[model samples]
Target: MVSYQNNISSIDNNADADIPVAQYVRMSTEHQRYSTENQQLAIAEYAKRHGMRIVRTYADAGKSGLRIDGRQELQQLLEDVQKSDIEYRAILVYDVSRWGRFPDPDEAAMYEQTCKRNGIQVIYCAEQFSNDGSLQSTIIKNIKRSMAAEYSRELSVKVFAGQTTLIKKGYRQGGSPGYGLRRQLIDENHNIKGMLKRGEHKSIQTDRILLVPGPPEEIETVNFIYRLFLNDGMPERDIANLLNNQKIISETGRPWTRAVVHQILTNEKYIGNNVFNRVSFKLKMRLEKNDPSKWVRKDGAFEAIVPIETFRQVQAVIEKRSKHLDDSHMLEILKAILARHGALSAIIIDEEDDAPSSMTYRNRFGTLLRAYSLIGFHPRRDYAYLEINRTLRKRYPDLISEITSNIEKRGGWVTSNPDNGLFTVNGELTISLVIARCKLGQNGRNRWIIRLDSSLKPDMTIVVRMAICNSTIFDYYILPLTDFSPETLPFKEFNTFTLDVYRVDTLELFYQLTSREALQEVA
Candidate 1:
């Protein structure tokens, strides 16, 4: 057995002369959060100052703070103190709460009694107070502890509420800040007051640091990724592989993972929306699962890096196309079909003038400035094409060959001189024609033989042409052809509109009849 020190005579349970002293450090879930490390540091300093030999230390990363007995370290220490022949005489800690979070206050009282009754002294190196039969003072302390715990829970709620409000206001809790664009604190006027740049706090904004969306290079990367995935249907893993092979690093210069790719694909932040408390949990415990409903969602919260439709399209494709290597063939086939079908349902209203139209192939647009714009004063067809081919293929694969096959043109199917009823050469293929008059443009590009005004927009025309792009027994691939270039088809006021639809005895004729009757009435 170790001997007690003669110099420390205040407590009867002081350590014997030769045995090293032990420090008991614990962090209950309630206390182990952001400030636990500070507790450990203070206890170490206390042990050093007293010239005591530091024998051992016990720690719990994320146990509950409800009970003293709930703490393994406390139980072990109490058991050691109870042993008649144990050499340790003193137990040290940072505070009493570290002793227990919300145990039966009686347990705290009892643990203290056990130490006093036995030959062990309980010590709080920081509080420097005791539970030595001082019942009244201890009762008051316990009351305050209870209030503090309540306060902690209240504060947690308030913090979550505040974060949710921030996101709803278009502010995204910043994640790993991108290059050039570091996360910053701003005053009411959106001026940078403080910043986290390169994982370090800085006072001033340097030329190299950007407080905006991100560096141009990073923005370009984001755009590239959107195009590659949303626009092209590339799998998440494939996209990650592309980045890794190209030697591109994340915002922190680390290799990309499938999780990162998944996040990028799933992040609605690109669409000017914000998510709240993305990485928070029930406790600071590792491996803690969070409730999805608890996650916050806000719209119009930030500068949208991408359009909402583009973001939606990417999500839809991900949902439809499985991301497994074994399903690569099936994914590849679906993607090919999807690419041709285009994201027609994604509401792509924007288009690049000089470039090819985007995934949205079907659109409702009409112009009658050109001679062919209107078929003799008939109303123009303003149907947007959702180019729903894959849906058709998947929903009815047996009819793909017929739907994709072009219709054969029959000679003299119309009036003798062919003044009307001139269908596109391919008959089986579904096609629509908005019969509207075309007018001439003001200058070189807009000039048309049929119109006098050059600055005038295309006038409205009755859509009257119909051809079968695809057909089955009940359904047909019908696309209402909008005026591709209104400048070329100028219409005059004196013109008469005509619509012609070739309907067999049985096949689906809803579309054809709709066009024919609508045009005939206008003419």
Candidate 2:
């Protein structure tokens, strides 16, 4: 009964029947530039191949993938779909995850089902859907999407781990390696930079390879900024704009954000401790703000770029500055900052890769070398040489247990690299590491041990060098009695537990032993 034109018009109303197509593209962080651009290009190419007219293209820039509501373009597209104005033959994208991650998959699947009921189809360019294929295809597609989410999570973990390691190494991890810092590479043997070459943490590790502590000059600059904001009453935004006006880009080549300026003024690394595992989460795929209780902070890992006194002063200033702000809102922002940066304002490390260096070893152990140097232990080598020294496990099987017990008993670090002899819990708060030199002459075989009786847990000392002296003298000190301070300090009961006949020193006995403090500080 109906006319031909009316019949054709009825068929044209179908949303899937429309030839014109629209494209949607998105990226989570500022880092995913290429992947997003590639997706957009792929969508464009698909349009050309299908002979479909190019229509509106929606894009969400700098949007996160954890939640869908935050994406502006996505919401717009959804609203347009609800209005049913234009027929969308297909909503094209590289993959379903390009929609969003986390709660996004469930939300997207629901939205897709609704669209299907409305006579629309989503054409994922990269994912070729097949109904007749193996059941594993569906599982694989789901896994692929899940992996995209996992990829973000894994990347966060790797970045955090890498950065933590680099920060510990003192090679400069980010932002022009804080004042007075110079990057150096550890040779294969883990010696204090076999050559004073570039630090590997900066060049090959993460996006933050040049994360180093402040050098003296830069330390001054850091101090200046902190003082300006707190003592001089300067504002964060004003400081950022001021730095930008001076054409001073941050070490990463980006204009200073107000947040970045604030962080510089508040960071503790500038004082010289390399804290690690401070703000970590199991689900890095959705790294939310971390709880302070969950943070693992190790003090004194590397040589401090800034003075401990200055670092304390800066924290005091920040506390005074932040106290008056709205706690609820500021806490939220702070939480976000913690999630993104783990309380790091700026790191001074090297950004160039050194030969025969793995980014991992440099970051984890290198920080401890710097820390030991700061407290005055004189770390002998760089990350390249840590394995040479870190063999404490092989040398002293009870090393970790001893340290852990000391920490539990005394409850604080005494001193690192104590007397190089028989280490014992002397007083309630004392730990002794014996340092002995074998006499070189006929007397070299007979040695006198210099015992530095210091605090134990309350004053934990990391003994870096067990005995680095004339080789022959090593045998005499190797079996000296001064190794046990508590036994000599009126602890007759402890004497029974101390070693009676000490082992003779050989080339293998001449390695460094980390105090509990040094071990906690590095990783």
Candidate 3:
């Protein structure tokens, strides 16, 4: 448990009473003690005692403080502070932790400094420290930040341990139960509740989930896949092809793939063996597959969908296939494919029955590029894109910084998330910067293909087109999300009026769009 030093004191003497202030409150679902309403009550009381007027409020309900990625309200408060004619002179947060519990204490400090630099005072309404920049207050604030971060770290550990315990006790951990299984909810007394449908979860605290056989048709499909692999000696790709040919869709309502078939064949859950810790993606870090030795297993956790003996036979076959093809043998097959097809790709490799799967080659040789290099077959198109992509990656960060600086010059604040390069401008517009590489066509025409990341779902996308040899900028396209829906936008040297209208030599217009102008009233 984490504790806050709630020595709420009077507002600073240097500040004028009855000054306008903005109260910012945030609450994660982890605790009820720091709900937005509770924080607002504390902040309101502090404002009343200090003679400060609450002119505005920013609340992030059910939002985590670990990162500012989803907390739009706090982001707005930060952006609002940088405005020249900002209404609020001070920001009232319930406490330092409530402001943020960023893993890096420096990040919390950076935000506070951004507020200070813009002449906006951030007062922790519930903290004991006054945030006066005094030596004692600074030390206490730093300690509080560390404590908040440490509390998260501790909670993560406890949660992982609890989940692991639950897994060992034959209860289902996260993730879907696969194609032929359904999640069944049961009470603490082991009474059968109902089967949880897709996206449904148990609301009762004492309720637990267990994996059971799904629909009859899905179970038949699972058994059929196993029989094809074992009895008929069909490869995973062939099995997938046959399933797709029969118009049998997977759990995701999509055609079956070799990967999905392989998962169904190899996953031990079909044999009623519960496994955990096969992969770890703790604390929003990169996903990593753990070693077999580290995996926690509980056999016969659920009813067996396939016979354990048959499952082992299937595993043996897979293991033999993997171990049978050494590096030299895999390279020989790849070279044969390149010789026959005059080109190599994942699809081509998967299509070839004589050749090992592209994934097998990748696992053995780090990546398909390395395998291709070994086989002396390099796809010119892929190589060109790789070089251009590398160059674009190198130029991306500097360009983002330049855009951010330009926006600041026009009195607009930019808040960015390092995880993804999505940034919010003045808390009103979310923008994604894409650098389109120039490709020279056979007809001596330069073309730029902009691959917009619709997943980021930026309100506006700013595409920077490069000139010949990608040596310099050609022009810019500021496209709104509403207008552009396609994942890829191809542009020739000259385009139609609809697209060319967005083209500009400079972002002067864009900067102006974000600029906040002070209005003057004439009596």
Candidate 4:
């Protein structure tokens, strides 16, 4: 005989005895009838009739079942069952649709099989089958999974059609109002209402939304950007710099970027036009940008912030400058700039009024360096090194603070030298932090160059190799003084055995290396 403890009843071998089980529930926005509470109540009744006691519950509320990516509760339940010592003998779910509406029925079957392989049965309480591994039950489950996936497909098509109808009627479908526009709330009869603030939505179901001109400063800024591009002939980057230098913030309360400036210059909404379906992400698949021909447009949908003629002129100027420049012409301009400045870079190219923007050059030729090669100009120094150094200078203080905090948390002491910024850990070992910029070689492989600080030779050097974007660290290398030689180390892409022994993904290894240990002396 087996004794049970902690309110957990052991699984009875007798078919008549009660078995311990867990309940899983999920509810998406599509249906309130299959809500989490309703699913749980149905599962409770099913468990009582089947002589099974509910021991645990997992639920995901207001989550889509199209993909398992966002279902945290279901993920946790799977992880719990994967453990070797899980107590439950069975898992009860509301139905097949509540499990998932995965486009592939095999994906839903795989999840159910995983629970069965762990010596636990998965019972679809709301389904007609007994889930007893019979041919009839298997066929019904497969059919139900396919039906659930089809339901999502049909629903998506209907929702898109409804949004298109709204767009045709000059009602805003969704998304925040752009920089120089505010969303105006109105009743069904098209009566004047109040303006909606950021993140505020219409309270009544019958209300509609429309775009209206925003504040005077925002409207003036929009006009100024158009004039800067059209009349002054300033590029997007220059206009962004002008706005940022004046401490003017964008509608999103962030510093103006070149992309934001360009969007304002090109967007049709500024001229009282509504456009929809510029992109599509159907059935939770990859998002694809659609061609302009596929876009649905409604003219004079909102109040105009910029005149139509000025907007068209600006568009023509932008198109002539960007699209009309062939590769050879762009290269000739680059050569002229290189001849005058003795070097070429994105910033230098952007500063030139006669030349197209650096982004244009990049789009024409794969990269700036590639364009330089076409023009027969090889830079004497790697211009990227300067940018990488500047980024490192901005990041070093935060990295040092994090390291110091982690060391102190582990009961260890850290002191930094004011002269060279070398850290002495536990008053025993000195460490220097260095950043290595990642570069692509001619063979299309990743490489990192580590330039050691010989003048401030410490006990250990911590090297952070940046990723291709030069924004985040790819990997870390901790090298002791004795293991490193020479002033430079060039690393290739694949060096897992030798160089990878020193590579780590996080600072946790450093914490382990400097952890405090108690010592005892024996007589």
| Winning candidate number (TM-score) | 3
Question: Which of the predicted structures, 3 or 4, would earn the higher TM-score when compared with the native?
Answer: 3
* Ranked candidates, highest TM-score first: 3, 4, 1, 2
| CA displacement after TM-score superposition, residue 238 of candidate 3 (Å) | 1.9
What is the TM-score of each predicted model, taking all chains together?
Answer: 0.41, 0.37, 0.70, 0.67
Give me the overall lDDT of model 1: 0.47
Q: Which ten contiguous residues of candidate 3 have the minimum total lDDT?
A: 1-10
Per-model CA lDDT versus the true structure: 0.47, 0.48, 0.82, 0.81
In angstroms, give how far residue 391 of model 1 lies from its true place.
Answer: 39
lDDT of 1 at 267: 76
Better of 1 and 3 by TM-score: 3
- Candidate 3 residue spans exceeding 4 A from truth: 1-16, 324-337, 345-371, 383-523
True-vs-predicted CA distance for residue 405, candidate 1, Å: 63
Tell me the spans in candidate 2 whose CA falls farther than 4 Å from its real position: 1-18, 27-37, 48-51, 61-64, 117-119, 131-144, 171-267, 280-523
Q: Residue-wise lDDT of candidate 4 within 1-523, one digit each (tens)?
A: 1112211222454544678789999988866779888989888887776677899999889888988755767777877888898978888888889999988899999888888888777777777665666687688779999999999899999989988888888888778898989999999999979999887988897899999999999999999999898889888889999999999878876568777898899999999999999999888866678889988888998889999999999989877766677777878888898889888876678667668877678777877778888888878765856766786778888788788898988888899999988999999999998887787777767888777768787998888888865666887878888766653353764452334456667879899788787678888
- Tens digit of per-residue lDDT, candidate 3, span 1-523: 1111122122345334577888999988767889888999988888777668999999999888887655667776777787899997788888888988888999999988988898887888777776777788899999999999988888789988988888889999878889999999999999999999987888997899999998899999999999999999998889999999999988976567777899999999998989999998765534578999989888899998889999999999888766667789889989888889788876578667557876678688977889999878876655446656776888898788888998888888999988878999998899999999887676757888777766788999998999855646988888888876674353786554345556677888999899886679989
**Candidates 2 and 3, the one with greater lDDT:** 3
Off by over 4 Å in 1: 1-95, 98-119, 123-151, 172-174, 178-181, 201-211, 285-292, 321-523
